[model samples]
Target: MSSHSHHTIRQAILDRIQTGEWALGELIPGEAMLADEYGCARTTINRALQGLANDGVVIRKRKGGTRVCDMPVRQAKFNIPVVREQVEALGSVYRHQVTRRVEKAPPTAVQKRLGLAPGTKSLQLDTVHLADDRPFAFETRWVNTRAVPAILDAPLDEISANEWLVQTVPFSSGDVVFCAVNAGKDVAEALGAREGAAVFVIDRTTSLAGEFITTMQLYYREGYQLHSQL
Candidate 1:
């Protein structure tokens, strides 16, 4: 039999999750079992399951086994004001507009996030988050070119920089921070708010073995809320 790519395996796993075949809190079949069902090697199944766990879509543990989490971490963001859910919750159309995507030496902010010097090149993606044709947020993301060189050919607007990079590049560790801030002119304009307006700010930095992967800043309009319940 031909070897199956990890992407194929991942799609099959995602299908099972979406179809309710793998109910929340249910343990996934063992690697050997999955391999037999899919006619693939255990390695292929491992790659797919590992990726799902990294994306917070499922829970995987050595002894606990892989299981559908009753309250999946991915869904936790929905209770929060995720850009996608924020727009959808308002009963308006959600849209993403890429402002710019460029490769250049790291900016000051990038350096701060990655602990890089002045000469390191990184891919920068700037975008506006929209709802019903109105600007709602501004997203600025920087990816370490050394970590994910294929980012050069990736399309903007087709997918979020954060989502695409996360799937394409595997990072060992990362951190997300949320805060409240007063928006400046650029942020206010992009988010359609008055200058110095109150807004929610989210900053994320991801790395692998001390090597930087990406840093993202999300600025949301005032009144935005991020909630999570255990």
Candidate 2:
């Protein structure tokens, strides 16, 4: 099949869903059946289904197959930019440093966010990203070892965790929240800003299937703003 066939199939399936031919909570045909109907390979149908699943239009299960979501949560799709890319896009030298790496029981807040058991252990990383030899952002992240064990052996000192995870991991669903907060002592020191100064905060959580992957909070120094176009 041609490369554009998947896009055609994706649009066809989306039209079916939007037109109510595939009603909510209805189990659609499996990939093999769809491929037979469309005269394409099963892999192509799987790709289309995956795209729908990623956009929250459908839900997929290993044994239960794919189904229309009862309440489809439309996702605002955007590329998760790597820290190095964000810095270099502004014509600045990008640098990364790993300040701390440890395996320990996560704090109550993180545990609650990841839906971990009481005694779950996670890999915590503290990193500072630099642009042109100046502090850019301070990052505190927790990786669910059970979901992504390969992260334990990664060389984070050479690559920021944000950059590495974006390149290596395949997350099915995630959410990001942005806010403004007053920098505390540690954050202030890391970003070379005065304590209590206003800082931009980005909190993100990623998951694959039903398993948690990582949760991170990034603190950007004063005057930082995130710009994007739809």
Candidate 1 segments exceeding 4 Å error: 1-82
Q: lDDT of candidate 2? A: 0.81
lDDT value for model 1: 0.73
Largest TM-score belongs to which candidate? 2
Q: Per-residue CA lDDT of candidate 1, range 130-166, in tens?
A: 8888887899888876655666777757766755654
TM-score of each: 0.63, 0.69
* Predicted candidate 2 versus true structure: per-residue lDDT over 135-183, tens digit per residue: 9999999999877677787788877889777655555577889899999
Cα error, candidate 1, residue 207 (Å): 1.5
After best superposition, candidate 1 residue 81: deviation in angstroms? 7.5
> Which candidate ranks first by lDDT, i.e. highest?
2
